[model samples]
Target: MNYRQEVEALQPQLIEDIKALCAINSVYDANTVAENRPFGKGCRKALDAMLALGRADGFVTHDVDGYAGDIEIGDGEEGICILGHLDVVPVQAENWQSPPFVPEIREGKLYGRGTSDDKGPLLAAYHAAKLFYRKHPDCRKKIRVIFGCNEERGSSCVRYYFEKMPACRMGFTPDAEFPVIYGEKGTCSIVVRGNYRGGKLLALHGGTVANVVPQQCSAELLGEPAEYEESLNKFLTAHPEIRAELKGQQTHTCLVMYGQAAHASTPHLGVNAVAAMAAYLEKVCPGPISALIHRKLTDYTGAQLGIQAEGQLGALTMNLGIAKYDGCKLELTLDLRIPHEVEADALAEAVRMQVAEYGAVLEYQAGRALILDRESKLIQVLDAAYREIEPEGGEPQAIGGGTYAKAATNCAAFGPAFPEEDTHIHDSNEYISLTSLEKATAIYYRAIEMLMAD
Candidate 1:
């Protein structure tokens, strides 16, 4: 079948499906979590909605205790798989042009929370597979499209699904940039806790998740209004890019700092509000936590922690993704993307030692790096499929972002994001273009055809 023509013909249906899926507000709610719905009501609804789509199209669907679900195209035991997630990172709706859950189309772009991250890409791959199977219904090999609901929160959904199910022959996830991803850096998050005897620094908070650079940070300092206003003004003058304010309270002053948010994998692209606040505190209300954050957390390269390293995949990068201080105790979660050459344990130990010096304790969870050989058949096939779709596309590359590919065997994260386009993923006004959807659908169709060749 002419894949491009088929995808183009189905644009309207595709857009509606994307809008419907994106409308669910599946952000992994902990409040409504239950026995079957492990990721909570929002994610469960998303998983159910996706399964309904598959079942409507005469495909076999399975809900794996709500942690994840799968739609199978055939009866064969093992074949190609398509991995995609339904859960999204938390969003500050006030920053969006429209209600985030209400999907909108502006200038040929579908705007919503999960539109760019994985939902749009997930459905693109789904429609592509649907088209392929519609042409080859009698084909023996099965095509399993897995829908994960906890990808944003450490991919526990896929982890549980794969644990309960069999691994596919090979697959690709539509969760990352175009061309193809052959390698991915290892990801780890370290939890640091420290106690502050100083009464000047009161409550502090920042960030929503451990994978996004915090855009806003606030700290309550026990002091008069006049104590911090002058110094904050001078600091703001020095760094005009940072937006901050001092709100006076009866017994304390609230210092609010604002910065640009970006995916933790590319921390350099973001201005971390937590780090900026630390810098301000280091200057005015100097304390152990502030000094530690200012000295070590400000740099994304792990330079201050003395654990920077680079490998074939990429360099080590870090983000101060979460921070909280409740008057006396401070807690922080630092997300680190480590290259393959650097041992995750060694890196964690180095950070632990550094954090220990400032009277803090640390605990970590390390996810190993994924390195697929460029010369491997899987990479060659995926690369060929991408090149066939876009002749002028760039070579396959490594990314610091972790995806469902890390949890699945014989799979890598393929298209959805084009290098030139900024989808604003993990931020407000996230979107997926109509052009991207059509192109990626065609690419996935071609890749599935090639993978399932007789």
Candidate 2:
């Protein structure tokens, strides 16, 4: 059945709801943790807002102890699930032309921090399920739209959810690129820390999380701002691609570098500010942390670290997501997307040994990769639903992104992001096109109808 008209009819409310939800700075805040508010007050508010939306529409909703929440439609025991996250990555507000939390529409696209990440897609799934049951009251099929508050960090919210609730029959997460995703790169975060003493650098900081390329990095060095001005100008002139400036403090000079931010899965698209700052530091200050970062982090991939690998899915990638050096201690967080062909253990050992050369200690946390057969029932049904709408769409593909699908069984990342469209998720000026919003809503509606049929 055609759902274009029904999906379009919901656009006005959908936009308003998107604005309301995206307005909350749902970035995980450790400072605001409490009993019922785990991720933070922001995420807690987003979760409550979503659950309230479900309840207002007459659906049964569960709080799942504030780590996550779900809205249940229909009274059936067996059903399909839709997994999504309400928590978003941290944003560098100065990079945005419009306030990151204040969503606005410009030229037919909704722009906000979470507009294209998972919030927009999550609502699309919600509206689709709402539309489905509204159009078919007698339908016994169930749809549970799960919202998690810890996806950007580690998805502990959904992990806590399944501990309290049972997994559904089959499901999909509308948090990735279009057509369908049957394979995703395994993800891991490696943090290295060490001591740095008697260096020109006093303090260095960059990036927010281990999943996004840092957009801005600032370092305070032991010198006059005027002392570094000529050298900084010379450096910027020699390296025209890098954008940086020196800020003066009484006894120290602060070197700030600005780079483009992109999701860690696609680090090549962004210029890592930390790496750029390290390059400059290696020349002027020449400390262990700066030298190591300059030597190791210049490449987006892990070729310098010798952990790069290629498999059926794709080549491995690494993002120097977070870096900090406070007078005495140095820390760096690297986010790596590994292919199945490479052993994660071996890669970790290699990185650990490399970092040890610089007198640093390494800690690694590994996650599982997802790989499903192309002919599986879930893939077949989802592909059919997608093909029903766009006959010329691409086949099921693999991505470097880690989605909620990995946290559940019999699930994969599905549409919300069209292949040709770059929503600039996890970056400044992130937006979701009006056409994509309506199209994704209709696609979810069709997928739900088809999944419920069988």
Query: On residues 1-454, what C-alpha lDDT tens digit does candidate 1 reach at each position?
Result: 3767888998899899999999998987889999999988999899999999999999889999999999998776667999999999998887789999999999989999999889999998998888887888788888999989999889988989989998867899999998799999998889999888764888889999989999999998888778888899999999987998788867778888988889999998888999999998888878898988999778999999998888899899999999999878889999999988887788888998998889999899999899998888788888899898788999999999999998999899998988788898988889999998898888888898988883
What TM-score would candidate 1 get against the native? 0.97
lDDT of 2 by residue, 75-128 (tens): 777579999999999887887989999999999999998998989988988889
Score residue 23 of candidate 1 by CA lDDT: 96
lDDT of each: 0.90, 0.89
Candidate 1: the clashing residue pairs are: none
Error (Å) of candidate 1 at residue 11 is 1.3
| Deviation of model 2 at 146, angstroms | 0.6
**Native-vs-model 2 lDDT?**
0.89
What TM-score does candidate 2 reach? Answer: 0.98
